[model samples]
Target: MAPKPTSSIRSFASSDRFLAEIATDARRPGYVLAGDESFLYQRCRAGVLAELAPPDQRDFCLHDLDLAEVPIFDVLDRAQTPSLMVPFQVLFVRGLKTLYGRGQKKEEFAAIDAYFRRPNPSALIIFVADHLSIPTDLRRMDMQDKERFERIRETLGDWCGIVELSRVDEGDAARWLAAEAVTRNTQIHPDAARELVDALGADMMLIASEFEKLALYAQGKQLFLIPPQHDQAQPVADIPTPTITLGDVETMVLAAKQRSLYELTDAISAKDRPRALALLHGLLNASDGGEDSAIGHLYMLARTFRQMLIILEKNVRDSRAIWSVLWHGFRMPPFAAEDLIRQARRYKSRADLTRALRLIARADLEIRSSPPDKRLVLERLILALASEPKPAASGSFHQFAIDL
Candidate 1:
């Protein structure tokens, strides 16, 4: 038979994977149970420790007993016996379905009932886990999953309480870096710290290791200086996006006005006028139901032209940042922001910019005010913006404000 296709979900080899692997003829040297992903890595170590130790600090180890076939009296003796040869012993049985609902299998009611009745007293029972996914098969099984979970909690009694593991959220990454910097006495600016997050791209371990590098590099170096050695890492965090800049915000604003005129121009050059205008109409609707949006669109076109002039004047090679600036303001549609900068310069002319902005202003007015033929008005606006005239110092900014 062909092998089952692998799961497409992209979490760290998650607890669910571990659980799915448990007792499906993949048993370890000992028995294994399915568990939760959220608590898997964390509880595994401590659970293993507990399973290896004596339950009551009595001088005994579960290893001394035949895990497969120890007699009741012999096992009882082992638990009661104080010994120099053996220390505390814990029995290990995993896969508590109470903590983790059965995913594609039937609930092991009989197994659970038997296990609870004669639980090896030496074992420090544990339920390790990740995230939960209710299995499709269980929906047809009539398993009262919640009730079973409650039953397990009752069976465990005071012997076990749920222990939570800490996972970091996006908001905490910057603060974490700042703390790391302080610990190492390195002056990591907030932007630099944020860049660290970007570099690691939400990989917490990677972020942690990089922050450690900051500490390591700081040693034997001047306390007042951060060495240039650590600057070469091309991690996204180093991209200097500490806070949302005004330019970045402006791109989003322009994008909301309609699709970016700069991008549309390429389509127009390819004689794809309809496609170009569609983008314009989309931007036109973004400004909300107001005349200000019309005006805002014009200013946005002017601004893009302004940026283009600046780039040309400065003779800047950093085209990527220019595009990021556009993505932030004009709200470029979702795609990689890296390539759009060079693209922005392609359909460039001051005249085109002026016309596009003027078109946006007109669309904003028609959409907002008492204008007839809304659809036709939009189509006209799209054409005007997509194939705007060359600049001649005729830019209009009639105040397009979004009423919050």
Candidate 2:
């Protein structure tokens, strides 16, 4: 017997499964979408809206409410009342965290339980708990989010179906990129898909947006086709398929930003503190969230340092060798292979790279603690990483000095 295909072996994304469920139209009276993955959240929302509220009858059938502005009782009342203009109603409720705020929500829970007992046959309610962030791997979910997830299960899960919208895995994201390209009458080169996913850190929204630009770029490219040879009666012509290459991604996507990231790493590796700080400021200024994006910058920094550690441990000397060392979904873009190898060589040993990762982790914790000045924390981290290691002391204190 032949082996099973990869798609068959791997579980489908939660968002995809939810979309399929929406197509059947055999949904429950209410549901709770649990996660902060906006990409998957939007996908599920679009699927629900497309099924429940067609463009022609959207205004009459669809309703958007927030618990922060409107009370749950009013929302339940809206759901209970039937609309004269439309046959069915769909309510999207946001700010679910407000329900679990201070004090016991006995009245609110009672109202919800009573409403669900005899729900209107013509209406559907969807509660969006976007405040909880769910990672691709459930085992690694944050403790607070895990608690929040369980709380919902204990309460709302009794009356509503819970659909998790977790982050997409890198491999799944890349496969989706290829399949999505095919839907656009274009083929995405495997390398291009990998590069795109790695570059965006498997952010589906960014991948989807960049893929649109890539598809358009591929479609608009001038095709060079050879004329079919003259035949006696009729000629068979071969049509060429448009393909999105890696070069296209590097040209169209946020390649400049990635390049700046590499440049920052380069400065750090070379022990140039001034240049590294300058590059850091440039990165922050160019970002949409300014200092708020410090976490994202720290994430990328940690990833690059980890890559350098692997390169150092494997003794990878060139780009060709680097591929064999770095596994798929963890590899960097081809353009940075040589630069990374050079940077990795600058470190005296794996200890140096490990120290860098440790410093990054400290900075991450500080930023998460809601520091008054996130920029200063990042600057201190950079300064620490770019500084030369202290010379080892002779005697019993040598190990202690190295630990410091």
Candidate 3:
């Protein structure tokens, strides 16, 4: 008998159930898609469009609006007014945070309440609440995010359905990667699945994008391995299946390139400012999006710092122990295990690693604020991270003298 499958292979119930509702035409007047998981959000969007707005009818039926540009009253008016060209309409509204901005906007909530009370039968609205981040374990949610989610529940939950698009668990991501490869007539080794998910920090959007490239790479490998025979009559036996291995994942995925990221961290941990700056430039130059990819770089940096923090806290001395300390999806690649442990040990204390994380977080905020020179912002961040913290004076408090 075949071995029992792991429970981690289960489908994404939240989005899948929402899709089922769409298919059965049991959707509410509006829905609040709560979370920043882009992969699930896209899946939900595709399902809605496929069911309500077919290709031919999309021109007349689909409306994409942002609250920053359009007011809630205008959106309601458009929803209420029947379209002569189409029988059904779908509206996707972004920038939902604008609604809950400063001041108690009783009028907006009242308007939303009134519209849902007597909603149009032919219209559907999807409010994207991506400003918040919901982790796989809801109990560990950020305090501020918990408050925001509660406010949303108290307000939007009353009328519109709330569909959460939380972060995909590492196990689920690995299973999904394996299952997805089967659909393309390819096989992904279990090790490869784990490596891919862990290397990309279990960010589903990146995993999906990189998986496509790996699939194509695997196809090319198969073509090269089994050369086309000139005689059509002869059939070859024992053909090897096209499979993606852990090596392939490390080779193709940019983040999986251990040398690129680990080397940068090595320099940072050693306080090699010049080398760190050079490595940063090399990373930016190699990426398809030079300055624009600053956020991605910062994410990897923050993740690495967090991993190091855990390593220090646990006193992980070897590669084997590192695995147990860092959970699935958050672990570094095997080749970098020793390197990372060494780097983590270079830190004097947990406070130093947390300080590094705070600097990275600040850089992330500066990048998102639309800085005129993103490269300069990253350079400043690197310089601060690579510099040694000044010793505290007798009277002064102990703190890292961050220039940025």
C-alpha root-mean-square deviation, each candidate: 20.4, 12.5, 10.7
Q: What is the Cα-based TM-score of model 2?
A: 0.64
Q: Tell me which residue pairs clash in candidate 2.
A: none
Candidate 2 C-alpha lDDT tens digits along 1-404: 11112242122455556666655756788989998777777767877877778888988899999999999999999999999999999999999999999989999999999999999989999999999988888998889999999999999888898998888888888888777776788999999998888888677788888999989888777243434464536633675677899878877787536888999999999999999999888887666544558988999899999999999999999887898889987888767899999999999887778778878988899999988888888888888888886756767542422333
lDDT of 3 by residue, 1-404 (tens): 11122234443778877777766657788899999999888888888887889899999999999999999999999999899999999999999999989989899989999999999999999999999999898998889999998999999998888998999989999888887887798999999898888877788999999999999998888766554663547654666778999889877887677568899999999999999999988887766544458898999999999999999999999996887788978988666889999999999898789889989999999999988889999999989999887565556565654444
| Candidates 1 and 2 compared by lDDT, better number | 2
Q: Indicate which candidate wins on lDDT.
A: 3
TM-scores of the models, in the order given: 0.30, 0.64, 0.67
**Tens digit of per-residue lDDT, candidate 1, span 1-404:** 11121234223223334334432444222232222323234334433444344355534443433323443334334434455555434443333443343353223443433454554443333343223222223343224543554455554433343332224334455665565455454555666555555533334555666556554544434423444555546443423222322232233322222335555545644446788777667665544634455555545555554555444444445643454344334433333132234544554544444444555565666667757655566566555544435333435444322111
Location of the lowest summed lDDT over 10 successive residues in candidate 1: 1-10
Model 3 poorest 10 in a row by lDDT: 1-10
lDDT of 2 at 299: 90
Better of 1 and 2 by TM-score: 2
lDDT of each: 0.43, 0.83, 0.86
Candidate 2: segments with Cα more than 4 A from true spot: 1-12, 223-239, 255-257, 260-264, 271-404
